[model samples]
Target: MIRTFFTAVLCGLLFVSCNQQQNTTSEQSATQATEANVYGASFDAENVISVTQLQDAVAATDSVSATVTAEIVESCQSKGCWMDVRLADNSTMKVTFRDYGFFLPVEDLKGKTVVFTGTAKREVISVDDQRHYAEDAGKSAEEIAAITEPREELRFVADGVKLQ
Candidate 1:
């Protein structure tokens, strides 16, 4: 009787341990899958921009189309949901998805080429937010303070962005 009871307990413990390990592995796999699918379906920059240009196209049918491609200069710390890309003109443009949807790792986007379709509007960021952004961009205290006052600048809310 003693031998049987000991054997039963040992088998039960092993089964529970194995079950726990399986559950952990499954959870990790699910997390990775979720991450992989977070960025929405991959799209070409041109297609994304085409939809954004519809309004402008309608306004002036003969107007020449404008498209922009730039390197990601900065990204949101929380994720790649928002980023600022440096244009060929040496201007930085804020790029966020339409309706504030979806996110990506901002750090992963730095130095990447991103093509986007959107309208660029001039906006003034709050001083505090400006300081924070400057710091995040690796600016020194003196550099940050010099431009602490709100400044108007162009910002782009992209309908779609393709990173290369």
Candidate 2:
């Protein structure tokens, strides 16, 4: 019968439409999940400079906003509040979160490459602050006590950091 054929065709079309919609929804969810997995501030990697460039700028006493990509040598073990990013010559810069807003995962960041977008400032870190940071890094008591003098270093306050 013509009616039977038409009804079957309509049902087939409806089934196909529903299947396609479901697939689309599933794909969107997966994409969103992947994007949400990235940590820190969202940053464009194109303008990122090398750690050596940042170091040179610091040596020249240039305080400016910069994007630098470097390997994380260490992170604060207590709360992941800060990290030490390494330069090409094995120098390290301390990176802290902006406005105390966000912290990285302490254990998961070591040896990972990250792009930081923020300002690098040259400042003297006091003995107390150095010892506190050393303790937070899980350093031994002797190591913490070794921080007896304030030292000038490059400190970066990152508005956003993206793991590469």
Candidate 3:
């Protein structure tokens, strides 16, 4: 009789432990969902650096991994494939998603704040590409024709983004 009683107690304890574990998992999922408007990949919106800090880092290194908070100066009106953000130096840099894995909503998100995880690098954009981006931004024909010179600028490839 004692052996049967002990067996029953062990089973009850096991059931309770499993039930608690399941509840914890569900709670975590709920928290993540309510955290932010996650896009591309899910990441905790932490360790965020400023766009000014990003400018310094980009100038100092060829590439750096970071999470940055910045305001959108412009976005791709055509496909939301990329965005331009103002940096500390009063210049704008283009930000694209890594591997075309995700895209932002096709709307004018200017002045909206966003936090994203990505890598930044410096590169020289070709004249053709510059014109292409201008076209995507719905520039005037005169503006598109004026993009005759290649420009060097900072660029970012974000694997995850959180539109705040």
For all predictions, the C-alpha RMSD in Å is 8.1, 6.8, 5.3
Q: Across residues 76-164, which tens digit of lDDT does each residue of candidate 2 receive?
A: 99998999999778878899999888887757578888888989988899999999999999899999988899999889999887776
C-alpha RMSD between model 2 and the true structure:
6.8
TM-score of decoy 2? 0.76
Residue pairs in collision within model 2: none
Q: Rank the candidates by lDDT, best first.
A: 3, 2, 1
The most accurate candidate by lDDT is 3
Whole-structure CA lDDT of model 2: 0.86
lDDT of 1 by residue, 1-164 (tens): 99999999999999999999999999978876754533543444453343234334434543233345677877877545578877545667666676777666546567877666656665678888778776766677899888747876556666555565
Candidate of highest TM-score:
3
- Model 3 ranges off by over 4 Å: 1-36
lDDT of 3 by residue, 71-92 (tens): 8999999999999988887789
User: Per-residue error at 15 for model 3, in Å?
Assistant: 22
lDDT minimum window of 10 residues, candidate 3: 31-40
- Candidate 2 wrongly placed segments (more than 4 Å): 1-32
Against the reference, the lDDT scores of all candidates come to 0.64, 0.86, 0.91
